[model samples]
Target chain A: MFKIFDHTADIGIEAFGETLEEAFEETARGMFAIITDGSKIEKKEKRKIEIPFEGDEEILLVDWLSELIYIHDVETLVFGDFDVKINDVLTAYAYGEKYDRNKHKYGVEIKAVTYHMLEIKRNKKGVTIKVLFDI
Target chain B: MWNGPLIKIDEYRYKIPESYKGKGNNLKMRVPAIIYASEEMLPSIKKDDAPEQTANVATLPGIIEKSMAMPDIHWGYGFPIGGVAATDAEEGVISPGGVGFDINCGVRLVRTNLSIEDLDRKKIKELVDELFRNVPSGVGSKAKVRLNMSQLEDVLHMGAKWAIENGYGWEEDLEYLEENGCMEIADASHVSEKAKERGKSQVGSLGAGNHFLEIQKVAEVFDKDSAKVYGIKEGQIVVMIHTGSRGCGHQICTDHLRVLENAVKKYNISLPDRQLACAPVKSREGENYFKAMACAANFAWANRQMIVHWVRQSFENVLKMSAEEIGMHIVYDVCHNIAKLEEHEVNGKKMMMYVHRKGATRSFGKSRKEIPSKYRNVGQPVLIPGDMGTESYLLRGTDEAEETFGSTCHGAGRVMSRAEAKRRWRGQEIARNLERKGIYAHAASWSVMAEENPDAYKDVSQVVNSAHGAGLSLKVARMIPLGVVKG
Candidate 1:
């Protein structure tokens, strides 16, 4: 599950999953939801990304989102779904196609992923993550 | 949320003494923090964690004097949006958060002899549409011109000079830009291949979120002599472009911020926020980030230069007059988000300092060689762009601005979030509202119209008036928009 939260001058995302990886994926979905304004983005193209993971999970989360933002800015692609695996390294397949402003409904631009109030909390039931974007 | 001790110093000044942070934490600030604001703005100023960020900035090592904020302050990443801080050249540190993600995110104003009487409402709409077609804007917009890696490097180095040399603009245009649109210290070699790849196609495009191109008319003139010196008069048409270094700057900030975040551990520096990452100016990491950041700053200058060229073309195409014939000359350009090495007098002794202005404009008074020679007697022109459907200001810098290190407010700082603004107003309704106000508007996405509804921002006139009252900058003239093209 994922949800969007608001700040006075910025916005953030809160996501939840049974595992840490699931939570990261849900957070990515939450970010794209802001980009596409919750419009349907078909998985016509698939792009793979790899990250040399660091020991710090928080830094890894920022790196993950930053890498995605780089791809979106350069390739003009928006993803609705992401498949992921994590060990000592992170590799993922992001599923989406070139963003069509008419079809996808253009939304806010995410300049960079910020570490402000970033979190990864694990409760007995599930894992939850929160992140903010500097738009 | 940030309920801290805010001592009212005067009608336009407030202070947060160094003792407010208390003695409990290891991150004791070295100096006090001062904010320039009016009494009426205190409630909304304290409405967020902005003042807390202002105080956090005071903790940086080697920060000189007081960490200051302009009246348009708002909660931003590591620093408040309208924050200004100067540090000793030898002992200080440079933080990407102080410079912002969009390095050299600045404003450029173009003046024309044409007046409101020369064009009717239909012509204004046509010109606005022409600009929308000529300029690539909105989320993830690409530039019209493609550059190879070698060419992009020259752009990263030469800035607006490269654009003018490549036939993008006129030869005389360089004189009006801050730093002549190029920082000679810029070394593109420090920029990453990833940043280069991102910048390869996005040079001239205007990115989304509060960035725009507006066709405005001089609505008011407060100082006749200064306005005359700047060649601005009531009823005259002028164009203003608001944008910055796009993806290239963001990547540079992100890349360096990561290294600096680690440098904090390497150098054993303690800070309140991870985002306020920095390294000493003398350190290898700090030097490299500054050089790479200079490249991004140059990139933004070239980006604005190219847009100015196209803006001229769009005007010519619509008005059927050569740009030169229209007397469309640049007034002046200023970078609100940047860190520059400058010389200032401190306690009767001159010292070099790196002045970081995040969402702030330099308000240098008369006789500063850093400004253009044409206006040496009148001081530099400071451009403050208001939100859409509001009145933007043309102000003059004053030596009195030295109180804030010669810096002033940037614009109408955000009082509400985009999400809330979108939730409250529909895009179509906002467009209709603008039409009722006789303003022609176009956006890449209508949803952006709702997201940037004019009501979402503080009254820019109020902010400008505070700056004027505080003696940071003096009001010269005001410009109201007739047509707007939003990214």
Candidate 2:
């Protein structure tokens, strides 16, 4: 599950799941929700994403979201879902198609994923992750 | 969250002494920090973590004078939205956060001979729709012009000159822009291929979020002499373009930030926040980032120049008059987010320093050689745009602003979050309200209208008055939007 929070000038997302990987996937959904309503996006095509571990889980999470933002900006694709596997490296598959402005609707165009107030937490309940975007 | 000591320094100034080392840090502040705000504005300025961020900026190594923030201060990453910092050229460090993600995210104002009397409500709507059609905007907005890798490199190097040479605008327009629309230090090779790819098709486009093109009428004139010299008169029509380098600039900032983050550890430099990632100004990493940043800045200049061309075309198409015949001329363009290396006087001594202005404006006073020769006696024109359904102001730089390294406020600044605004207002209702106010607005997304609800922002007049009271910038004229195109 995911919820959106905000600051005075920007917005952020917090996601939770039974596992860290699931939390990552939910966080990706929260980001897409900010971009659009997220229901119209279909898994028309799949792009395999691989990111080498950057030393820590915090940096890795940022890399994951940034990679998606980069892909969204350059390729004009919007992903509503993601399948992930995390080990020494992060391997994932993003599912979406070329964005149709009329069909999908317009939300904020995020400039980049910011590291400010980024967090990853684990407890008895599960795992929760939070991140903010520079709009 | 930051309840640190703030000593009142007269009416428009507050000082955070150097003794406050912040909450947690081994790095000591090299210089004191000052925020130019009225006594009544303190609560909101301290509402978020912005003041702490301002304090964090003071801790940067080799910082010269005081780390300053304008009256429009708000929370931002690394530096407050209206933060300004200057550091010694040789020994100080340069941070990517200080420049913000949108490098050269700036404003450009163009004037026309036509006034409100010449344009009716119907005419305003037609022209606004024409502009919306001509200028690509909103999510996934693509440019009308496309360039291959080689041609894109020329744009990175030439900036607005590339646009003018390509028949996008008038050649004389260059004279009125800050830095003449090109940073000669820009090297295309320093920019990464990904950033170039993102930029290639995005040129001549306006990205979403607070970026807009507006047709406004001069509503009030404060200093008639300065207003006349700047080619602005009460009741005259004008166009203001607010946008930046788009994805190209974002990618460049992100890539460089990663490098600077690593360099922080390598250089053994200590910073209170990791986002303030930087390297010594003379280091290879710092030089490379500066060159690449200049490319992004040039891209933004070229982007604005192309939009200006489209704006002219849109007006011509709607009114059946050539732009030149309509007397459409650029007044001045100012950058809001950038790090520039220039010479300024420090305590009565002249020295070169790197001035970082994030969400701030460069307000060089009269007699500065950097300004256009035409406005030498009155000083450079500073464009301060207001939020939707609000009044924007035109101000002039004051020599007194030198205390803050010759800078002033960028905008009214956000007083609330986008989500809060979105939750409270309906876009369609906001549009209806804007129409009632005699302002016609066309937006790509209804949701954006709600997010940009005028109430979400501070009262611009108060912010402008604070700057005027402080003598950071002097009021020239005020403009109220007649029509707006939002992305």
lDDT tens per residue, model 1, A1-135: 999998988889999999988998999999999888555888898999899888998999999999988999999999989998989899999999888888888668988899899999999989999999988
What is candidate 2's lDDT per residue for B261-353, written digit by digit as tens?
889999999788878989999999999999999999999999999999999999999999999999999999999999999889987899999
**Candidate 2 residue pairs in backbone clash:** none
Instruction: Note the Cα lDDT for every prediction shown.
Output: 0.92, 0.92
* CA lDDT, candidate 2, residue A39: 87
TM-score of chain A of each: 0.97, 0.96
TM-score of each: 0.99, 0.98
- Error at B274, model 2, angstroms: 1.4
Worst 10 residues of 2 chain B by lDDT: B21-30
Which stretches of candidate 2 lie above 4 Å from their native place?
A: B25-27
Runs off by more than 4 Å, candidate 1: B22-27
Q: Measured against the native two-chain assembly using Cα atoms, what DockQ does each of the candidate structures obtain, in the order listed?
A: 0.83, 0.81
